[model samples]
Target: MELKKNPKANVGRNSSLYFAVGLNVMLLLTYLGLEHKTYETETVKADILMMTEQLEEDIPITTINIPPPPPPPKQLVTEVITVVEDVEEVEETFVESSEVGQDDIIEERVVSVEEVEVVEVEEDVEVPFAVIERVPQFPGCKGNNAELKACFQEKMQEHLQKHFRYPPTAAELDIQGKVFVFFLIDKYGKVAKIQTRGPNELLETEAERIISLLPKMEPGKQRNKPVGVPYSIPINFKLQEQ
Candidate 1:
């Protein structure tokens, strides 16, 4: 029973106070140990005011005499012109009023009609190859539907094969590309408006030249009327490895 002494006394009551004191001390130490930011003091240097001597300007009062403006020029007087009537007197003939018989009455002078030239305007209508009633014919394409189309294609291929000249620069540089050419056959059976698209400019130029050299063919007809035909074809420019 003697070993258990002060059992009813509170031991943990002062521990909180000690912890608070320790925490405050640690905070104070931390605050002291941290690098403090220094602010530079604003230096207000008093500048001595130098009195500058002011130059006195003597103002001279001068009176200027302005001449009066000249009077305006007198206007020209116009003479009154008297208008004299130059009427030629026609002799008065008294004719008694009588019945206007067709044979006795004088006929009024008739005005002749003036002739004018009539101008005619012609516009070429464009039609596609697939939809036109009568397809365009090449030089030697004289046949019906399927045969005509086949003959046209055959003639076109033959023409290409004959006129297809590879550009010297393209062959020299080994440049190869496919050029798409779009040409129009006018109503007069003349090839016009040739355009080309390709990877190379030289290739495009060559294709356009070949297309432009195409001979005049019979203009395509739609509903038995001649029309312009828009045809597009692709030509390949390939360099052979020799």
Candidate 2:
């Protein structure tokens, strides 16, 4: 068959013909690429499903149960005891004789008796006297009660001159105080149980020493009998002003 072409239509158709042909070729290539991608995806999915089914059939599952350990054995304990015996003392018995007389038939009676006595022994203790004659007296003390207090004060002054050593801090700081000491005038009139009532430990110690060195005096008299008496003394400590 012979195709007839118009001159005007051919002139207009030639310019767009090349562009239309290029567009159709691009569309056809895109459709073919999409179909190839779809086919590859479906093939991969089928292979994954088959692998999953084979693995599920090959793997096996198991369940196990374990029991706990047994308890330990019990131990027994034993204790032993010992006993001792005691001995008792025996007592002695005495025999008695009886005599009978004629006429009235008088009988002499004999009596048996046990006697026990206790004896206590006391040891005599001789106490040594203090060496009062050796002690140096204060200038005004004449060994009287009033003089004794002055003698103690003088002894304390002597002690401070010889042995009144104090700590460096206390000495440098000029620490000074008064201590009240209470003591007993014993039956022999010697100082005993001297104790301090205030601070100043060094002063208290020196005061106690002075009191201990005091000589025996006539004991305090109450109703004309020697009786214990309480005595209080104040020891004053002061720093010499330079």
Candidate 3:
């Protein structure tokens, strides 16, 4: 038998076909891998961007402003007022004597004598006569009235001499003033409820001291019995050269 050429064998005999098939498979695998890697990278980048934006939004910033403060109040002042009473002295009058003549002759003679002045001598020294009226005593106390008046005058004089002496500064400045003090003599003749009515501190202090040192007065009597009485004492301060 003679060898004959097979057409089918001839048909499958192209090297280029096999090469094309292998190249197509390799290209498809490479395209799929590349697409997968691109998607993963894009997702990672988007996540990172979102986290950065959120961090920026969560932080906060602030600003502040402050102002200043205000001042104080004032004080009040008061003035002092003093009241003084005037003392008047009484004048004495003398009467002349008339001489009587014989009744039948009906002649009358008037005799005039020179006025004689009686001078007051104190501590062996002569002083001008000054008449001081006796202070009338409270009613119903009888002889005790005279005694109480004398005692009160003496005590007042002594108290003035002792406690009313002012400081040299006060005297030099001529600080002459008066103060009115109010006090109550109890049933037992004790000085109580003493109060001063003026604004001068020094005057008030002196008045208080003098009033405190006063001896217990025999209580003012009503029908010969002890009774409480309220008294107001006016204290006068004057400066004289020593």
| C-alpha local distance difference test of each model | 0.88, 0.60, 0.63
lDDT of 1 by residue, 77-195 (tens): 99999999979888999998787776796979766555555678878689888888887889988878567778888999999999999999989988998999998988888889998
For candidate 1, the 10 contiguous residues with the lowest summed lDDT are 109-118
Kindly indicate the candidate among 1 and 2 with the higher TM-score: 1
Give candidate 1's TM-score: 0.51
Highest lDDT among the candidates is held by which one? Answer: 1
* Residue 217 in model 3: lDDT: 55
Error of 1 at 14 (Å): 51
Q: How should the candidates be ordered by TM-score, best one leading?
A: 1, 3, 2
Tens digits of per-residue lDDT, candidate 2, 2-121, equal 988877675665768888999999999999988884334444444444454543455676768777778777677777777666677678887664654464566587755544455787
Candidate structures ordered by lDDT, highest first: 1, 3, 2
TM-score against truth, every candidate = 0.51, 0.34, 0.36
Q: Write the per-residue lDDT of candidate 3 for residues 1-242, one digit (tens) a residue.
A: 99999887786678789889999999999999788743334444444444545444556666666655544556667787887666877789888657665664664877556565668763311111111122223332335445656656566666667776564565666666788888776656677889986546776777788888766655665545455566677888777667
